[model samples]
Target: MANTSADDLLRTARELFAVDGYQATSIGHIAEAAGLSKSAVLYHYASKEALLDAVLAPAEAGLAAVLHRFPQASDGNRAEFVEPFVDFLLAHRLEASIFINQGQSLHGIPVIDRANQLVQQLAHAVSSEFGSIADRVRFGVALGGAAYILAAQENWADPDDEPERDDEVRAALVDVVATLLTTTSTGIAATRGD
Candidate 1:
C-alpha cells in the first residue's frame, strides 16, 4: 500500500470525476485510478461528496482568482473579466462539461455553495459598478447565458471532430459574449429609466 498525499488523491479524483462524473465515480475507483488503497483514498476524502469537493476546489480557486482580478468595471470592460472564464472553460473542457452537466445535482453541497457565493460576489461587484440591482441581475444572467452558449458550442464543435475549426469556435465565443454583454447592458439601462 503506497502512501499518497491528499493532493495526489484530489488530483486523481478531479480527473476521474471529470471523466465519470461525481455520481458515477466511486471511492474504490478513485483509489484504483490513483494506484492507492481504498483506505488511503478515504484518509484524504471521507466520502464521495467530500471527494467531489476536493476535486472542485482548484476550479473554485481559479474562478475566485478571476473574479478578484476584475471585481468591477465602469468602463464596460466586462470582456476582460470574462476572458479568464472562457480560458478556463476551454482549457478544462471535460471538467467544464461535468460542471455544466451535473452541477445542479450537487448544488446543495458546501463546495457548490462556496462557488455560488463567489458568483454572487461577482454579481454584487458588478452591481456596485453599475449602481443598480437590475444591472447586477442582468449582468449575472448575461454572463451565465454566455457561458452556457460557449459550453454548448464547445461540446458541439469538439476539437477531435473539427480540429480546423477550433480557432473559429473560440472567436465565436468571444463575439457571442461581447454581444450578450452589450445587449444586456442596454436592456438594463432602458428598463431602469422606464
Candidate 2:
C-alpha cells in the first residue's frame, strides 16, 4: 500500500468531517478516503479523537496568533482581534462550520476543551477592553454574530476562483464587526419618583 503521511490523513479527514459531520465519519472512512489502511491511519493518529486535533490544528493556530498579536485586546486594538478572527473564519469556513455547528457535543474531547478555554480567553480579552458587564455581553453577542454570519454563509470550497467576490464578502464582515464595537447603548433611567 502507498504511504500516506499524517498531514495527508488530516486534510482528508477534515473535509470528510465537514461534509459528513464528525460523528458520522469514522476511522475506517477516513482511512479509505485517504487511500491508507486503517492501521496506517491509526499509526499516525492513535484514535478518532486525535484525528480531530489534526483537523483543527490550523484554525487553533490562527486563534493563537490573534491572542499573541493582541496579548491584551484593547478598545484601540479591537481590530486586532476582529480582523484575524474574520480572516480565520473565511479561510477555514468548513472547519469553522464544524466548530460552530457541532462543537458542544464534543465536550469531553481535548480539542473541544482547549477551544472552550480559548473562547474564555477571548471573552476576557474583550471585556477587559470594554468596561462594564453590559459591554462585555455586547462583546460576546458581537463575536457570536460575527461567527454565525461567516460560518452560515455559502461554503466556497475554492475561494481562489473569485478573489474579488471573496474580498467583498470579507469587507462586509469587517464592517459589521467594526460597527458592533463602535456602537454602545446608553441607558435611559426613569424620572425621579415617577
Candidate 3:
C-alpha cells in the first residue's frame, strides 16, 4: 500500500485545520484543498479525527525532541536552561501553537498521550536541570508567562496590526525570565539560610 495518498491527505488536512480550525473544517474542504476527490480523502483518512491525529503526530515528535534537548543538572545555573528551551519554542512556534491551542480536539488520541508523556519528561528534566524544587517552580512560572505573552501577541492580536520589532519582544521576554529566575533563586537561598 502506497503511503503517498495518506500523506497527501494529512498534509492538506493540516493546512485546512490551521486556516479554518477543526470545528469549521470538513473532509470535503480538505479534499478540494488537496485537489483530490472526496472519496479519495475518505479512503486515506477514514474520518476527520484520524486526519487530526496524523497532523498532530509531528507536534508530538517535536515535543519529544525538545524534551530530549534539555540540558542535565550537572551543567549548573538555571539560566543555561532558558536559551535552548526558548530556542526550541521559537523554532517550532507553529507546532507549539497547534499543540497548545488545538489539543482539546485531540482527546483520546494516542498522540495526545505521547505529548503528555513528553511534557512530563520535560518537567522532570527542568527539575533536574535546575537542581532545586523552587527553581523548577520558578522556571515553570516564567516560561508559562512568556508563552502566554507571546501567544497573545502573535496569535490573538490582529494580523494586520503593526508588527512589533522582534528584538524588542525578545529583549523583554529575556528580561522577564531573568528577573523571575533571579528573584526566585534569591528567595530560595534566603529560605535555606545560605
What digit string (tens of lDDT, one per residue) describes model 1 on residues 83-102?
66667656655445555556
Ranking by lDDT: 2, 1, 3
TM-score computed on alpha carbons, candidate 3: 0.61
Query: Whose TM-score is higher: candidate 1's or candidate 2's?
Result: 2
Please give the range of 10 consecutive residues that has the lowest summed lDDT in model 2: 185-194
Each candidate's lDDT (Cα)?
Answer: 0.65, 0.72, 0.65
Candidate 2 C-alpha RMSD relative to the actual structure: 4.9
Clash pairs, candidate 1, are none
For candidate 2, lDDT tens digit of each residue in 1-194? 23446667877898788778899999999999988899988877889988888788787777767777767766677766778777877887667666655678777778867776676787777556566666666776676666655654555436656443668878888888766765444321222322
Residue 66's lDDT in candidate 3: 62
TM-score of each predicted structure versus truth: 0.65, 0.73, 0.61
After superposing candidate 2 on the true structure, give the runs of residues whose Cα lies further than 4 Å from its correct spot. 1-6, 129-141, 148-152, 155-164, 187-194
- Candidate 1: where are CA atoms >4 Å away? 1-12, 33-36, 91-101, 126-155, 158-169, 185-194
Worst 10 residues of 3 by lDDT: 70-79
lDDT of 1: 0.65
* lDDT score at residue 184, model 3, on the 0-100 scale: 52
